[model samples]
Target chain A: MASNSDQQSMDVNYIARLARMNLDALEARQFQTQMDGIVDYVRQLSELDVEGVEPTAHAAPIQNVFREDLAQPGLTQEQALANAPAQSGGQFIVPKIVE
Target chain B: MSAARYEAVIGLEVHVQLKTRSKMFCGCATSFGAEPNTNVCPVCLGYPGTMPVMNREAIRLTVLSGLMLGCRINPRSKFDRKSYFYPDMPKNYQITQYDQPLCLGGGVEIEGASGLATVPLTRIHLEEDVAKNMHFATCSGVDFNRAGSPLMEIVSEPAMHTPEQAVAYLQGLKQTLMYAGVSDCNLEEGNMRCDVNVSLRPVGATALGTKAELKNLNSFKSVLLALRAEIGRQEQLLREGGRVVQETRRWDVEAGATFLMRTKEDAHDYRYFPEPDLMPVVLSEQQIAEWARGLPETPRQRRARFASEYSLPEYDARVLAADKAVGDYFEAAARGSKAPKIVSNWVMTEMLRRLGETGQEIAAVQITPAALAELVELTEAGAINSNTARELFGELFANGGSPRALVEARGLAQVSDSGALQALVDQAIRENAKSAEDFRGGKAVALKFLTGQVMRLSRGKANPQLAAQLLEERLKK
Candidate 1:
């Protein structure tokens, strides 16, 4: 609900940290201005009457569209991991994630 | 303060894999235990330029499940992208229902210690299941066979206070879903999984306390054990004047303890947005009605019917109604016989015992419902004594055959011919003279001894009723 000027003062560094991204000082300033403009555009809708208006989730009017539950041939083991940067023993290898 | 003064608040989120033939959005087969990565497609693998098309059967099943649970199906629902990063999720974002779920506002009734308690449900949403991740000593493997399978996420209100109630609620939910044919709900095969949220508050407090989320609960028994351990841990901390932190805890099955996984601050910020590739689902009144008509009778309705129609005890009806396969089998067998209780007894005792010993499902049992009913009828008509019937049951259980034919082929039919039994009774009276005299001298146990002699002569095939009549008639003379 904050105005565009209020959003401009928002900390871009904190947001970047939450998103796990690193940004330099000039990039942070640039992102802050861009975010402020995006927030301002979304904020304009708040002035309109939303009472009794069901929110729209999709642009199309269709619902319940579905395909039959039929199985078709799919990729082989090699093709499945083809996009992986690292692979070992027919599996995609990533940095170890401790559980 | 004593731990007794504190009560636990519990809610569960259960993820059940629907029994659909294909993947939720692709043509890949949903069969389990297939070769790893064999079921993957470009759509499920999250490759560029791939669009998802919803599976109609999955939608029908979700609606049917909602109807069975007494939920209100939303006229309009759409999928959302829950953005996150996990090795199991190839797309790096899961297509789930965020604000507009398919079903809302339902409750499952569980039998608590006091009586029936209704555990209210918050919502039931449809989503695609992530792939399974397997960990080894040195490396981890991901299987895409389970990915894109139709998964239903059911969230419950924090209405349960004890572990027993939680387990009961789970059992009730599982029974309902199974009856509706929504899912198999098998725990070991990962068809169903549960995450538990629990917190303890003073007995009289109204506001809820900070709750801890327990994950990796594979079975109902594990859910109970994990809750007990988590509740104990919380109580001990509170009793020592410490505050319980709100965090996600991993339940270590081998260690039998809950360990800190992550705090609330470390939770994933799932930037949810509407899935643009798929269309919003709109349901017409006629479509809803059609789906409703196809739903099977609920477990509650079946239990009531079993009691009235079959004349079964309430306990028996409850047990039979808990599983649809068992209930259907009972009905099929009972329909052929007048004595339904007899059929119920066999199913509950001998049939169930055999199933347990052999580790076979009821559907896979050798004895069909009609065959079971025939055995019951033979016993009821006195063609075979109860003892011989039991022995025949063991044979029929081991190797399938008609009871009537088995009785005839094995010479197990009762010797009820009056002329044939008269000779056995005379022989028994001639051999055990002291027993005969004791019977005439008013010793009642001597009559039993004579009956045993008649049974021994006939090799346990003699009709004990006619033998007793013949013995009493000769004793009077």
Candidate 2:
């Protein structure tokens, strides 16, 4: 993000935490170098803006694609929980959720 | 530094579950209480290559609600992906509208204040609701039946100063949405949920204070209690030279206070970005107008109209128009009736009382408005005394039938004919000579006792007005 400096720094630990990953210091430092390169390229692209171009949300210029409100048959209980690592009483089970 | 000098500033974020037939993006049925994961599909479960398509009815219904609330429709709005990590949503993010929401700048009219006032709205956006998590001994089970159901969030500005005003705002929105047939708005059934932000500032201060967000206020009573407690807590802390922290709190109904849930998170943490999978939603004026057509008048408008049209008192109009079904029933029974005030009294007292005691819905009650009107007319015409009409009312209320047919079949009509009344008047004079003689002896109160005798002699069908007049005339001689 410090585009003016000759060398940029990236906080890989912060990014890894947001992505729900646990990494060692060595791996974090290595990933930080790779992330710095990615950010430098993005900083270069950010310098050339026309100031009048509209921001596009999607690549295709389409709108208002909708389906009717009729219900369609979805998966059965067996099919829905088929790939769960843990299951009980026909439901997918995870570790106890607390507030 | 006085506690009484501090005023509470409050705002609410309300979420209402739309009564749609299918999910917001996928075709899974949105039925509540279904078995766990039965409504799951790859599109809602966030599987690869599964994209979302909008549901037309959900969009139309949300727009209709916006129109009823007097919001401006945006011509172009797009979806944004709000990044978060939660087990309820499989994609680790939620598809919502951040900057470009669908409707903007509406107000809800609340009258529980000194007079009618409008609480200004920030915006209303449509999104998908998450799944339900039920905890067991060591695990939490996921039920995808509620996932991807259409949910509408209405955000209000920090315009409320008291808890009652916030509740009035919620009730106002509930009535309008229910009248529009967009939702049931049943709070106990989890159809409507609310979160409130509260802060306190000194009286006559222009600046705001740090706010705490309160959740799990399931009912209006709890909202009132929790807010009062939280306001007291903040005032005490401020008086003791302590600072209020910005945090999220959960209401404990049993404890009568709010406990800290978490320290507040910054908005930047969500990292919202435009959704790449969804195209921008562009609506035309023609489409907005078409959606607005045939929308019912809001509850506020209906309350005002009922006061003028039916010549009812403000109290009657307020109570009647609060519920859609009760308002419709009143209009049907009161239309073209000579005594609308009388009709209003009966509805507010007898009909509502019976409905409450019997625990029956107004729709399921066997009494038709036309039948009820006939009973009122019969009493007004003196064809049957009010006492006899009330007896017939009980039967008609329990079982549907014509009041006229029931009265005719039971021979319950009053003896208004002079010849038939003369016989009963003479029999009353013969049976109760003491009351007749006392009436003749200049005791005007004796005529009421004589009339009772005539009513008893006529088997409770004697018109009290005619009987009193006859007794007075006969005793004068």
Top candidate by DockQ: 2
- CA deviation > 4 Å runs, candidate 2: A1-10, B265-268, B304-316, B334-342, B357-359, B391-402, B405-411, B418-460
Q: Which ranges in model 1 have alpha carbons more than 4 Å from their true place?
A: A1-11, A24-30, A41-53, A59-64, B422-446
In the predicted model 1, the residue pairs found to clash are A63-B281, A63-B282, A64-B281
Looking at model 2, residue B24 earns an lDDT score of 92
lDDT of 2 at B331: 84
Which window of 10 residues has the lowest lDDT sum in candidate 1 chain B? Answer: B134-143
TM-score of 2: 0.89
Interface RMS for model 1: 3.3
In CAPRI terms, model 2 is classed as medium
DockQ, Cα level, model 2? 0.56
Query: What is the per-residue lDDT of model 2 for residues B159-233, given as tens digits with 9 covering 90 to 100?
Result: 999989998888888888988899988787788999999999988997999999999988888888989999999
Q: State TM-scores per candidate.
A: 0.91, 0.89
Tens digit of per-residue lDDT, candidate 2, span A1-99: 122234456677866877879999999988988888888888987788759988777778899989999999989989888899998877778898887
Per-residue lDDT over B1-477 for candidate 1, one digit per residue giving the tens place of the 0 to 100 score: 655479999999999999998999999999987777889999888877999999999989998988999999998888999977788886778999998899998999898777677899999999999987777667677777888999999999999999989999999999999999989999878898999999999999988999999998988889999999999999999999899989999999999999999998877777688998989988887999999998999999999999999899998998888878899899999997999999999999898888889988988777788889999999999999988988888888888789989998989999899899999999999999999999999998999999999999999999998999999999998
C-alpha local distance difference test of each model: 0.89, 0.86
* Model 2 lDDT, full chain set: 0.86
